[model samples]
Target chain A: MSVLVYTENWNGKFKKLSFELASYASRLAEMLNMDPIAVSIGQVDRDELEKLAGYGIKKMIAIENDALKQFDTQTYTKVIADIASRESAKLLVLANNNAGKSLAPRLSVRLKAAVASGVGQLPEKLSPFVIKKRVFSGNALAGLELRTETKIITLAQNSFDLIEKPADMVIEKAEADLAGIAPKTSIKDVQIQTGKLLLSDAEIVVSGGRGMKSPDNWGPIEELAGLLNGATACSRPVSDEGWRPHEEHTGQTGKIIAPNLYFAIGISGATQHLAGISASKYIVAINNDKDAPIFEAAQYGIVGDATKVLPKLVEALRKAKSA
Target chain B: MNILVCISQVPDTTTKVKFTDNNTRLDTTGIQWVINPWDELSLTRALELKDDASSGVAKVSVALVGPVSTEPTIRKALAIGADDAYRVDTEALDAYQVAAQLAEVVKAGSFDIILCGIESSDYNGSNVGGMLAEFLNYPSVSGISNLDVKDGQVQVSREIDGGKEMIALPTPFVGIVQKGIAKEPRIAAMRGIMMARKKPIQIVESAPVEPLSQTLAFEPPQPRPACNFIDPDNPEQLITLLQNEAKVI
Candidate 1:
């Protein structure tokens, strides 16, 4: 039996998330005493496929088909399910991102496999296939056990570290039979957000809230984000007031992010807001109120006006980077 | 066209997460239950579509897999403008069981459009819609930010990594909606709240599907350490701490 990892690529290049999935699958494969195999469905080159070897993937299946270029959910599910059946994959792993979230559930139903989505850590035990995952919007955790023989797991991004265990890998080309299959949905148009860091993929996020007082006072927030090469975000109230786009809202009803460093400037962290950002590794809050709830969740805080502290902090960071 | 919006009742967003029964179950004492924020938005969008006479949406209904105790939450959905509601008579266990039970309801109703939240705030499973679609053998579009129906044709838009894709599909599809589906969830007025009492709520028997996964235990997140305060006078000290102590920058 083999542990199958789906390494999705963007325009023939693999992102850090793919390697993280491979690393997670490799570790799980070790625990199960199974081979770690990777499957790539897009037009990834051989060199790109070989990178999985560093994560202990011994074999890679590369499927390049014109019909599979645009990523139809149904077609991709069929292709992956076909591969799993052929390889006798006992466990399948995917990233808990947009694509993975779309694919894992359909695959679970198709394969009759038990699925545990948004799994945050490695299994606590392998005998009964016990794993832990975030629940209640990151406010709590739940330990779950899969009772089915075939299991599917979607790894939460940035929750697992990338560990390198080098192995000699072989890449094989395969063809998917798409004779009777047609995409159920048709893509009419595509619009790609350009020239700005996406909040969901950013490593650092600088977010503002109602305490900014007005949309006109957003200069320092943007400047700080530009300096850190991070993305800009806001609270739900700010978005509702039309101070920022709804896409920039990071809260329970908005986008949930897990950046490495989250700067909550001029924001009193409400529980709903904290639910979206609590997964952030380091939280820094700058608020005039010393007892703001954000400070409770923040690792470091400055009890001062954000307008006064932001420019000075930006200058200090500029000097530090230059030095 | 009939639209079915799947809703789940969860603890209010501000409720403190606590466990009971040796950490195996959620404590129910003094906890206020509400329709999940995402599902509320989905119901709002479904009602919006139905409200537009040109949209050709005839009715909006809601389905939930919960016990009789959750009827109040279902009534809340009805008050928000769902024409009717269906409650599968079972406590929601895992995503699979919920999806299976919901599939039975959908098969019986034969709704043209099905709407579901991307994830519930409580379990955050993010699974039911796709699994339900698979169980029904219907096409599904996940992460839908914009959904519209014109002359009985459905169009949806969803965000990809750095892009947005607009999709055109036939009816009898599942739409896993997210934040932008509605500007804000609609609030029920006094008249609507009163009328909701007269709306029909059909309780369907639970399906025989066994749950594939079981929750063994629950635990609150580790308490964060006390915040390290930096003097407001020396703004540079915060940067120093970020560089040397936290090392995030």
Candidate 2:
């Protein structure tokens, strides 16, 4: 038996999550005393597939067909399940992102395996297969043990460390036929937001809350994030009020991010909002209320109006980064 | 269209999470319970579709896989505008078990559409909806923010990495919706609350299924370090601390 990692590609190039999944699968395989294999669907560069050798993948398989150019969850699941059955994969690893979250559950049901999504850490004990994950909006942790023979886990973004070790990786092309079934869903159109750091890969974030007052005041927030080479996020209320897109909302009902630094401007830090950002290494809260709950979680606090403090802080950071 | 919306009751967001029974069970003393925020949004959207004639939605049913303690929460949902309610007499064991139980209910009833939040607020497993689709052998679309129904088909918008993708599917599909699905939830009006008292609530026996995973214990996260207040007058000093002290710069 071996471990299988589903590597994702977008627009013919590999994503950062592809490397993270390879690294995670390699470590898990070492603990289970099994080889780690990567399965890729659709078009990905052969050289990019070969680069997985640096992450300790022993075998890589790429399945390519004209019909596979676009992502169809049903077709992808069928192909991956076939591969796992043929290889007798004991553990399946994927990133808990848009595609993985939708595919992992169906794969678990097809394979009759115990499934864990958004896993926060590696296995603590192999005998019982214990793992820990965040629960209650990151306020508490739950230690769960899988009871099934085979298990599927989707690792949270930025949760695990990537360790690289070169290995001799062999690439093989797989034969697949999609003539039997028809895909139910088809993508009619795609609108991609460009020139902004994705929340998943962002190392630093500058977020605003209701205290920012108006959507028109978002210029400084975006400017600050741009100056730091970071991403911009907002609280749930801001998104609900239509000040920002729901994709930029960072809270319990939104995206969970763990960056190196998180700047909370004019945020009061509700529990739901705190749950999504507890993983940040350092937190800085700038608000007018000294007793705001954000101060309890932040490492530094500045009690002032965001409109007055944000411009000065932006100018100062610009000078600091340039020098 | 017969739409089934799955929901769960969770501890209030402000309550401090604690454990009891040697850390195996969630501590309930003094904690207020409310309907999960994500599920609330789903219910609101389902009700909107049911009320609008052009949507072709005939009935909206709310289901909960929990004990009698959830009756009050279920009643609250009916008050908000569900045509009916279903309660499976069992505890929510895990994601797998929950999916199995809900799947059995969906199979027994003739439902054309199933709606649920992407994940619950407490466990955040994010697997039940997809698993249910697998059990029922139906197409599932998740992270959908917008939805429309026409001519027995569904058109949806789901979140992608840097953008959004629009998808189209036929009837008998599952959708795991998130926030942008609807506006803020509607509160239970006094008249609706009184009307909900007489609505039909069918209690069904839960399907027997063993849980695939067990929680061993609960632990609180490491406490944040002490905070140092910065002088707002000197913005440059804070920049210096970010570079020298935190070193994040």
Candidate 3:
């Protein structure tokens, strides 16, 4: 059979995670000698799904309906499970987004399969059912296997980079019956009531700590994060001190992330904090303390005051880009 | 409310995780154990419910399935304000097995509402709550940051990818509590400790339903490479380093 991937979106528009999931499913399908099929849902159109051909997807199947606009978990789960059953899909993949958060488990139950969430890589596919996934909130990797015939796994956001191929892939819409059931849950409104910070899927992350001193002075960090098209994160102390919302906290106790570039500003990293993002490709620590623990884990360290250094770095990037 | 709160005693978060001599087994000696930090949030919330319902009127019970070392952790829940506690005295630690234990306990109690940590601090698997829901055949909402109960139902708002998701579920459902639930957990006071003396801890011996796929030894990550300091003031030098030395940009 083939591998099935769930496409993701934000405000009815395709998101970066859709491409990443397609890429991951493509590779996993290759390793398993199976074809890759992406099931694009929500307000996404066929053209948007077909555009993911660059990720090496063989076919894009769109399931369109007005009720399918927002992320209603019951209807979404029903649609996915129904499609996977018809395809006899061996492995079902989903992006570890909020939609997948509730949908994955519900889909797993409907399909009667074992689910492995937060997966980081393809399985061994040999005698054992081994797949390496991040555990303990990305602190460590667990080598696990799914012995069940029908397997479902969710990919951690940004764990895999999509390769862009020039040739276009085929697109087809699937007319599926999700059956009749009143949705017990409702997504009332799409609230875009946050700042410029998009932590879950940002490529670059600029985080602050207790060193920022106060919330009023956080304007510079926010500006730098905005300029870089990155997100803002914080250490435990900052969240603990209420300088930033606890939702922004990234650590073993908070949300785990793995951005391409992580900028630690005025924060001394702790192991618990490092557990959340040690997978970041490049880490830059900007702390005045020469012996801060973050420096030990950081690829590049800046031993200077953040107040004096961050502004100049921002200015330098802007000037260098123009000149 | 028939509040059934599930907990697991894990190595304290601050512990320096070290492998044993063979680099296989985790170093067990002298490691302090506490309720998983996320699970502690569930305890805090459960206690709040108990206080709100006036104790015996609407009952609260703590359920855990782990080794006997978790007795104190169960007692800690009692001290924190659960009416009683139950610990499945088994050595199995697999996610499926643990979820089965919770399912059996849930089926027996017929809870109106259930609360559990989103994931275990030690296992970090984040599968138990979902697995329990799957086994017991019920709906579950996880990663809940703030929750309240009203009108024969519970309402919860969870931290989603870009924003927040709020859902309200009727009785007979599970909600996995997230860390930093509400605010910092309150300390166990002298009264809680005194009341815990009267609470009974019931231990049951039950066979594991099924073990999960094998898990390899815990491996502490390799130490990071040496840090290279650059002067942020010298943008030219930093840019060169990023391009040539680190090659991140």
Candidate 4:
């Protein structure tokens, strides 16, 4: 009967996406004439869940289960599907994170509700079940309407800004009957990737191609990405040539990213590579070829050797930072 | 080893897409549909595993949960390399719905390994493989950059934040292949293309599954203004423009 947000916690503190989802669901609740309730799964004490009241959530549902300590897609999905149905939630909102992406689709099927992922904005009151999302890797926006009785939606990363606000809310702890799923997937070890920006999570990305010549010369790309607090990516040719890891390749066949700023270094601007990055908000291509297709897509094109242009750009940024 | 590779047809990348008369349907005016790119990678890897295995023989079968129009792509998958193929006749494009139907088929077939593209180029949801594995109570991994199957176990290397995590799962699992898993996939040869004609393709009616979301209309992305070209030889001018106009600097 209300809008519910599955809040996320890391090391006893709420993840940034949780506040973002609560802030987002608050707007949706206002549209549906219902309250937005924040649900915290696992061993979150009442005090910890209640502290989320500062994010404008009117109510909190805390489910305490030791099994929920680590994420098992099946157990999490079962709990969410049960809660959504039992809570009589009209709409379920989640951040399109590792957990949310894995859980939302299954919950949708179990609840017979429409599920939307990579959702951007809430629907205008025109229809309660309508939502807008980025399609074709942010190349287009689509308004999708779910005609079902219940709906589930996953918001894309960085699309909705987290609100800094406080709320007066109620906290309720309910340990529902176990979803009957013993975790089959075990984390042999949690290797936290450190010392670099995550390509998928980065807002600003600087990528190179064979134009960088070799991996040894990749210091500039890494340095620039570091300065911007971004990630370093590469084209398919670079990966195939063994200059960079295949995971760094981004294109139609590679990872499709839609960062706020995409800086291409030495890429020939082939359509295949551009397919992955066309979704970027602002694309700046540096290549010697003025006729490169990437230039056509670039908001601004620099027709120069990437090696030469890159250093100057990095130098300029370093000086700007110092100033 | 019985491997089931799921392929989905999606609009070709770079296709200028728009909404149909109603927004729910995609307008195919100038657009050409192709096998999902990630699925193509999955297909390529599946074909490789089939070739490498000596005893298990890696019986590779391609399956798609879509309408008859998707068969051309299924045939394309056959051309790439597959022993047999299956398609559940349905017009549903939702990934979760497709996953449910796939689970029903897999339950009947009892495939030892499942392969899918990490994500479709069109929807880019990247959740189907994980959802399907969860539905069947099987171990699943997504965004795998490289994979191999041996000793009735599967090893997957997927890209994480900085490096890669190499994990092992039992045979009854799903592996979603990402791009860069292989270099330029070889187009089907004439013999392969001719052989694809004979591969048995069983079309089963899709069972009903609840859809999680609906699409009202497709909105094209905001157009970028014409590119501002800088003189190639002039380094200072380019630097000035990048700092003042492009603002990346």
Of 3 and 4, the candidate ahead on TM-score is 3
**If ranked by DockQ, best first, what sequence of candidates would result?**
1, 2, 4, 3
RMSD of each: 1.8, 2.4, 3.0, 3.9
- lDDT tens digits, residue span A16-58, model 2: 5677788899999999999999998878889889988999999
Which window of 10 residues has the lowest lDDT sum in candidate 1 chain B?
A: B156-165
Clashes of each: 0, 0, 1, 10
Q: Which stretches of candidate 3 lie over 4 Å from their true place?
A: A109-112, A136-139, A165-168, A188-190, A194-198, A318-323, B21-24, B53-57, B151-153, B160-162, B204-208, B235-249
> What fraction of the reference interface contacts is present in each model, in order?
0.82, 0.77, 0.38, 0.55
Candidate 2 chain B: minimum summed lDDT over ten consecutive residues — where? B145-154
The segments of candidate 1 whose C-alpha lies over 4 angstroms from its true place after superposition are A319-323, B231-249
Which lDDT tens digits does candidate 1 get at residues B17-90? 89999999999899999998888888888888988998999999999999999999999999988999999999
Model 4 has a DockQ score of: 0.47
TM-scores across all candidates?
Answer: 0.96, 0.94, 0.90, 0.86
Candidate No. with top TM-score? 1
* Model 3 agreement with the true structure over B114-138: per-residue lDDT tens digits: 8888777666666677667766656
What fraction of the reference structure's interface contacts does model 4 contain?
Answer: 0.55
Q: Name every residue pair that clashes in candidate 3.
A: A136-B124
lDDT per residue, candidate 4, A115-197, as tens digits?
77877677744355676777776667777777778887787655676665688888887785664567665544335667665
Judged by lDDT, which candidate is best? Answer: 1
**CAPRI level of candidate 2:** medium
Q: What is the Cα-based TM-score of model 1? A: 0.96
